[model samples]
Target: MSDSAVSTSRALFERASVVTPGGVNSPVRAFNAVGGTPRFIRSAQGAWLTDADGHDYVDLICSWGPMLLGHAHPEVTAAVQAAVGRGTSYGTPTEPEVLLAEEIVGRTPVEQVRFVSSGTEATMSAIRLARGFTGRDVVVKFAGCYHGHVDSLLASAGSGLATFAVPGTPGVPASSTALTLVLPYNDRAAVEQVFAEHGDRIACLITEAAAGNMGVVPPDPGFNGFLAETCRTHGALFVTDEVMTGFRASSRGYWGIDGAQEGWVPDLMTFGKVMGGGFPAAAFGGRAEVMGHLSPQGPVYQAGTLSGNPIATTAGLTTLRLATDEVYDHIGGVAETLKTAAAEALTRAGVPHVVQSAGTMFSVFFTDPAHGPVRNFEDASRTDSTAYAAYFHAMLDAGVYLPPSAYEAWFVSAAHDDRAVQTVLDALPAASQAAAAAQGGAR
Candidate 1:
């Protein structure tokens, strides 16, 4: 097909611009960083996306890390369909909510879990509960760690905020973020210094279990464990925001890689993405002692109109049930293959790059590893986004879709079979060359 054949998406984007802010629901989806028309997807199945212009590409974003089993898995779709036939939403308590909550508790260290409609809600409510429980006014978050777009967490956040180069969101009052201490991601010294100054006043310190939003920057050895210990010492709750890493990174999430092995658990945890089975379900939970502070059981009040909606819960529960060790094994194998292939291709093309991972989740950084791992947002920001934009467009042209921005993880799923993986491999050499030839950020 000719390049002009894809004009349908351009037209749709133009129409959307008139009605929607930035012509996209999410900031990153607008392709502003990449400088191209974002493909308007009509449908996705298994590991492929079919765009409105009738071109099909192997999907690598996986709805930004929710489609662990890949898009529209037969079993998950069947569960959601059966749930829909019963009824869409019922504000009343449902069996699926209890079952889903139980599944989460069984897998992680949480004794109880509370459902929410989105990751932002989960993190927002988690922070509120922490503040109320500790009776403290301050929160501490890592600079590159994103815990959704919650006003407090958005201060110096990763993901979209980092991708767009926003220092901190404008509308969020300075007072809202004044109490939020932003520190470097893997720097124990910075975390220690901040805690030494404000430990007693801190309600919670939240970090991504593994920093996926800033392109899969995994925690340094024992970094998360150290944070948990410090929080314990300082009487502040350690909140692990696993919205992107949960289930997709591993069967039990990044905690399964670190906490499960190291025998340290967070005081609180937030989850979303794969647990919802491609629906809008998320949660926050921890020890029953901490969770008891929320709602009718305690003074801290948090409620949602769509909290524990039946259909969403059903989808989440079913997805969690089907996420066995085999699913994680398959995803891991695919990620390993792709990571190796991408690194090799970049090296062959004489492109300076670094590949990083947190279990099955990973990303190829456009910066050289000589600068060291991207432990914080500053390091992540040093990436060659212009090189990546060229690489991304080349891959898109080769019928393989990559994340539109350099600071996002390239997600793989159990559905990324040899066929899908081969498509990506076939596209890599040319993409790497494009990246090598371009002057990053000069465009």
Candidate 2:
């Protein structure tokens, strides 16, 4: 059917369903939680997405935090184009990879790094390296803190898993999660208890530096530092997953918010999103001592055919080079404005809600105000997802593209100028009212 007969997004989705599972490669992209036709984006520029139907929406999701400098950023595009002319992949070491690694080491605490194709690979490799380095089998992760789809890490993940109400997936067997200890986020007592019970057997404990996957639930004051201290005491590696927050939350990512100031650093860190500048690139690195455990230096086996693709590294390197203090300041300012406007809009509509932030990244939870400041998965689960569904579609109709899932972070970019910000601000009040109306199925 043509777009005239049916909405282009719906038609395309129907066609895609014949070939791809759920008509999307990624589950959350299907809009399963928030019911609607997922807009098929044709192109993006600055902070706007032009859909297949020719409607342009202010892009608040920012490709889930990769477009820190915004879609098709001129400098980053030029860098990728230039690198492409040289060639795409070499399957061999490249100067861009070295430069990117140096840039990462310079900005963060990681001393050495290894490139991968996705955040999942970066994290999976980090965990394996942790196991090899510690000679232990157990891994600990926090509830509502997503590290990716690695078998062990997926036990109680957030993001798509949280949105779809899947406690854990099927393909992952019981044995896979046997050694995984899932703890509540921001609960130091829980961490201490877990370490007390399994300290010797624990290889590593990984967490989102600040939990963005569960809607920007930040670590409590001194919580990350405490995790680091406890891990150090127990001889377990502290693995901070910055895949979502790296470079997007701040110049040095979420770690810059507290870890740097408190003089605490994770033994390992995973990075992606903004570092790739929208390309398929990611990395994990840490103290040279721990990283050295990976072969051909050590015994832990981790390899990727496209580990350091030239063009991807060039795009990432250029993006990082351009992500200056001013870029972060601009994004931070945009986040503050939008967060305040969203909270006010929700209040005006008498809709229960809470806005939470971890540096420049944030999310609005459609939950009872009394139950909020969501700290863990249980608290996060209390959000009224149906109300968010209404709010999301209302904003979509009003020329604002938000994260389709309520559990995901809403990203802003340095390119979110006055026009884009105003577009979002204009949409919030009506969306909030839609959420209010949806409370009792009135909408």
Task: Tell me each candidate's TM-score.
Answer: 0.96, 0.96
lDDT of model 1, residue 33:
89
Tens digits of lDDT, candidate 2, 60-98: 999999999999999899888899999888888999999
Q: Give residue 105's lDDT in candidate 1 (0 to 100).
A: 90
Instruction: Give the Å shift of residue 202 in candidate 2.
Output: 0.7
- Clash pairs for candidate 2: none
Clashes of 2: 0
Q: After superposition, how far is residue 78 of candidate 1 from its true place, in Å?
A: 1.0
lDDT tens digits, residue span 312-400, model 1: 88888888898889988889999999999999999999988889999998998888779987777788888988999999999999999
Off by over 4 Å in 1: 1-3, 157-167
- How does each model score on lDDT? 0.88, 0.89
Superposed on all Cα atoms, model 2 deviates from the true structure by an RMSD in Å of 3.5
